[model samples]
Target: MSIVGTEAYPQDICSGGGEMKNLWASQRNNKGAASPLLHSRGGCKGKTQDCSLALSPPLGSVSLKCLPLLEARIVAWIGGPPASGKSTLALRAAQYGFLSADCEPPSSGPDWLSGFGAVGMTNRVLALANASSWLLGATTSGMVVGSCYGEWMPSSPAHIMRVLLLPEQGVYQQRHQQRGSTGWSTDGWRHAYRQYRNSLLVWQRDNGTSIIRIQDRPNETSCPDKTLFDACEGIMAHLDKTPHELCFYCRRTRPPQSAFWLRCPPECLGREGGERGGAGHASHEGASFPGASSPRADSDHSSKVATPAEMEEIKQLLLATQGGRLDRSATHNWRNPSVPGRYGYHSIQIGNVNLVGQRNPNERLNILRSFLNFTGKVVVDLGCNVGGMLHHLAEVKHAYGFEFDPRCVKAATRIAEIFHLPEHFYQANLNTFDPNSTFRGLEHAPDIVFVFNIGSWVGQWQQLYQAIANTGVPMIVLETNNDKEGAPQLRTFRDMGRKVQFISQAKDDVTGNFRRKTYLVTPA
Candidate 1:
């Protein structure tokens, strides 16, 4: 049977575009009986809307059939670099009652959903085919399409409802690279995918597609696709329970989860899980809930941003340093054995791998290490926003942190105490650290120090540069900006030539998106 989606024809329509074809029709002879999923539309161009699903052997016969029926409407595509836990997150959606499908290899995926049904297609390619051809659209039942190529825009005009899933490039690459030995061509496939994604963005803009940009890292249970399904369930439940005039498409008027609408499946009125108590917003309140926070999770205020090339380089450097998996035994991020942490640090999967650099401790360490080397003396985190990076660094030796935000200081100090590290936090801004501020409280002025260079504006950049310059300590800087404009303030450092050397490096992950610079400056 053909794997990728094939174009279909409608009653011999003389339309252009190479005559609507019957590509995968031959495979119908070999397939098993058709799935009895009822559809609002009988068929999309007479194409068999059979649920061609595969279940891993581990899941018994009863579950194989039951799982597909349990999924909700609306399939979401979760895309990022390869091996960025796209499949893992997709399965999590399946576990939570969305008929989930993924493209991971047989070894890692369920046996039932392993083959043709789980054919791997980039977001761009998926967009290239007609949208209604998707299984969810086929049955007129909402489904979650978890994928890593959230960047595709289809030539076929389909509904523009989608959610983007982004994991840290650093952690993603580190995980792949640490996998003993991935094929050398792996990087090439990833580059091609990124290009496809960029094209998708362009297409999205051209077509005026509605984009729901999800910026938060997927917490342990945050299934983007599944959450959407649950939201739909809640809305439907509320509408059925109330006598309100709620539209079938949207249940704004319905009292969500009222008594009347709790029918249990088969019938259009039945609720899949019986009582909708744990299926609504409250059940998903913690970190797993989608759109819990606005998408401005990455605070980008750097004065001098690295070029895309430079950013990719910085990503590579960070990935090289990311060694062992998270010590699951220890309270840290990065638990995958494929992507390990270093000797002096611990891996903590605080958020999704994509958001690791911004939120995950391992990524923070990767960014921080660009400047500080804790070989001789311990390093200090100047602004430990969350103790993610700080806690990992403390594993080495005498790592102290200072947070200007009082709330951050309390949290940082509390976490340090819990982690059994020395309570060393200064709840004051760096401006307050004048000579009179009693360096006595300082836990040995670190031989190395790290600043949150990503959010440093022009003024803060100058202050940090001058401070590092005066101290005569070699430092690393972090920054981010769209490729549209380069940062002017950092241009001066490059103008100095040999005084400040630039080291081209990769962002931790293999995807070429995120890269930064490490300036090796000799004291003037």
Candidate 2:
């Protein structure tokens, strides 16, 4: 038995200098059933050629008879326009044990994949392919697949992460040109790109889809392939988390029951509601603001403003220290009784400036509060970007932050001075950081040490862990890059003769994309 479907382009247009033809065929023999295959036929120059590609597992890899025992489920759906690298991402995800299937919409009708029609068609296609049983025993992570469009509403009750791949317009067009596809006109492709761009925001808000923007740049740090791989790894890590472990708004791990509700507590709800103008806005009104402020009262510095000369000097200092980028390390705003104007990345207002950052340091502080007491404790923060967390820990005896970036150190120092905070910032690269020598002159050891989202960057984990252990610090609070990194980090801690326990998987509000696992390390 064979199942075949053909996608044909208009005669006036061609792909690869010829009419584009896509054939999806699956064959089954008496011995077993072969996985589906996708074939493309087009002409280059004057000659017509056929290109056969196996888009799924090999024919005999998993027999049809074993379908009943398999437990495959769709973990993620990758959606984008043509040439946005959707197929490449799908294939890459398959390497990590995710079954991949290409479910393109019919070529003739635009409305075929709209609303319920799209969801129904996607379900039918996956059902026909036996997607649930494709590679059950092979890997537990399940599958990641989708169509060329950027909208999907799956009927499955299982959580399906929606990822939209949007490349730069120039890159999108260039990809089509490089493939020599003429079946679709430039105007048509441009229109599709515009539509995806315009509607993606609304779609994302409605469906909670994560959008990954792909840019074509020369920098190796921002390579599109690496970005996609990181995204895939993030999805895999997300699958390991239970529904109650992550927050509904931020997707970070939930704090313990003693602290608040497992999902989004009132704090997160207030923030989310304030951003989207949802009912959560009412929650924000009743929520107590962070810091030394009384309930529902204006901040002490609300009516204060920096002198004109001080404001000018502050601007110059910010530019010089932050290299003209106001957002870097400006996690919290310099609000209250200072110069007025919205500046920086975080949304909180400090003085007069509004730092519109994605992650709230206050929220992180609340999570940490649930774990340990900070009253009158000396704290050491490793890789403290701009001293956001240190600033919020006003109850601590004193806060010492070691940062790698000299510019960040300067910015953090200035902010501390401005607020009269009992915090100090120093420059030290954690890769070669030594706690023994660094803390030698201190009168007392830090009560608690915070290492957040910097373990992966520290090349000498053994040396660093050993030095930290030697410090005789009572507690070490660490936030790893992801769930996968937690085990290896814990092993390193064990090797260094320290007892490390996972606290929870928390969202690093800084980037807001990756969910990091938090651990508490104590001397053995």
Q: Which prediction has the highest lDDT against the true structure?
A: 2
Top model number, TM-score = 2
Superposed model 2: Cα runs more than 4 Å off: 1-353, 508-511
Off by over 4 Å in 1: 1-104, 111-358, 364-373, 431-443, 454-460, 476-486, 492-524
* Model 1 lDDT tens row, 1-524: 10011222122122211211232233445533232221111211122322122121112322332233233233445444544444544553454455554322233324333222224332223222223223422433434455435434222112213444433344344444543224336765577457445634533443322333332232322222332333333333333342211211121112244322233322333222112111111111112222212111111111122345543443343343333432434322221122332211122221111112322344334333333444335555555544456544422435555544444444444434332343355543454333122222333444555544433322344554455445544453433332222254355455543165443332433223354444444544
Query: Candidate 2, residues 1-524: lDDT per residue as tens digits?
Result: 00011112123211221211233211222221222322211101121112222233222212221121112233455666665666655553443345665555434434322432234454342231223222221234445665546533221112345456655556666665554334467786777667567534424333332233333333222222343444543443343342211222122222342122332335333222112210000011112212221111111221223456655554554444332323435432112112233222222223343243334454455446546767557787877766767755545655677776565566666655554454566666576666876665444457898887666656666577767877788999988867676667778778878888766554423344456777888877
Each prediction's number of clashing residue pairs: 59, 16
TM-score of each candidate structure, all chains considered together: 0.32, 0.38
